[model samples]
Target: MAFKLIFAALAAVSLAASSGAYQLPRSDQLQPLNPPIDNLIPLSAYIDGLLTNAERMKRGMGPARPSKFSDGSVTRREPSSTPTSPSNPEPTDVPTTTPGSGVIRIHDPSSSSTTLYWVSKDLNNFGEYGRTDDISKALTVTLGSDSGRFSIRTPSPACGCVSDLPFLGGIMGYATSGGDLKSSSADYAYLGATVETANGSPAVSGDNSFTRATGISKSIESSIWSISSDNSLTATWINADGAMVDAHILYYAADNVLSLTADPVSFVNNFGASPAVVSSWLSDSTLAVKATAAI
Candidate 1:
């Protein structure tokens, strides 16, 4: 600490009024420690040596620091004040573990969680519906037209897996284009984990707009975004039949595709049941409501 002060003083002097302009008077100050000295010159040199050593020791005690050099000039003056050992509030040992952290554990009040929602919007039209049931397998429904090539994506063993219930409520809406009836589209969502292979199928909701696509169907224009919590992200979904289809489905501007499956047979037959029916399709990738969920 003493060495730091001495260096600071030297540095101040070094930067003081460049050599050319002005001349200042020097003050004769008393020596610190009150020692009766003989040669002031030797004492000054000794003080300098001690400070240099102190500086070196300070640096050596820790990680490498920026290098400092001397200008080789010294001015005679009184010794500086007693070194002021800097005061720090002591380091705060933040916990290294989460939830299960040991030692002086601390909890952040700002922590939060959220539930992802698969919402279905209502678009006053006939809910699209088209599906292929394999006697002992699963049900497969084609998205509106060729919105995307994905069959075997509905709730039923024949379709390969079952559908899912949204984190919140299900959907119920009209379809601009009738599903399966046109063979051009079998509007129905696929429930899965990632989109490829599904844990199970569930009522789908990507498109939400009531308009159709240009040169395509207007029902596919309903597009809405899915949001979630911050701390953790969930990329999995459970099918409606209470099984894990383990498939994934994503929507965006580049890929305008969506599915809606409301068993036309049970549009009214199984209207009110567990994990209600979700019948709706998209002109592109947007999904409309009319889908259902009762759990």
Candidate 2:
């Protein structure tokens, strides 16, 4: 009975093999053990291409499209043709005076001295003063106490103070532009020196001498200046609770004299006279400072 049972099992295996019911899978029929992952590219490559296309479009050129080669290489489409017109020329009416080593001269209205006073940088790093009549010598004076020299720069939109120097790294402008001149710097310090009410008169003070810990009050609006086509600098100061006044770059007689000690120049709204008197002087070009290109 045991021999007959073994024989019956062998017969069943042989019958299945002969009928091709039991067969090993061929190479083509085999399935992958793991699913294939899609190819990945760096994000920076896409960003760079986007920037490049944007610049090309700005220049009046056709936008570039990326193409993939049979060998799995990518390349940008070449421009159909070169741009016919030249890149936009810089505006001719923009102020010719650039931010660099330059001379700032203030008109002296006195009959005794008709020469212009050069705005010399102070050693205190507080404020600038008018001391020298010679333009050549004034340019040699260091801008601030630091080794890096300072230059007058205009922030974007051109509504800020031209006196904004590189030493402080600030954007001096009106409150509407962004923030007040007092809050231009990140540290909440004044650029150069600022004029504020002191004992009922305008006084010049350093960054540390601010009346408030957060620098000048925003309502004062003292440092915002405008440059004209002739390169003349002018500014208007408006007090939220007081009268609006025009800014005049004035200096003390003692500070203007060449001496061993000098004081920073005063930026005042008046010289013990009516505001109209100051306005006339500015209109006649007899009481203003012109920023010119450095020699």
Per TM-score, the best of the predicted structures is: 2
Query: Which tens-of-lDDT digit does each residue in 64-120 have in candidate 1?
Result: 223344875554333456744438522222111222111111111223423212212
The lDDT for every candidate, in the order shown, is 0.24, 0.31
Candidate with top lDDT is: 2
Candidate 2's TM-score = 0.30
Put down candidate 2 lDDT per residue, 60-119, tens digits, no spaces. 334555678999899874433554443874343322233332444556454456675554
Worst 10 residues of 2 by lDDT: 272-281
Candidate 1 residue spans exceeding 4 A from truth: 1-232, 247-252, 255-295
At residue 194, what lDDT does model 2 achieve? 35
Give the clash count for each candidate: 80, 0
Q: What TM-score would each prediction reach against the true structure?
A: 0.15, 0.30
TM-score, model 1 to reference = 0.15
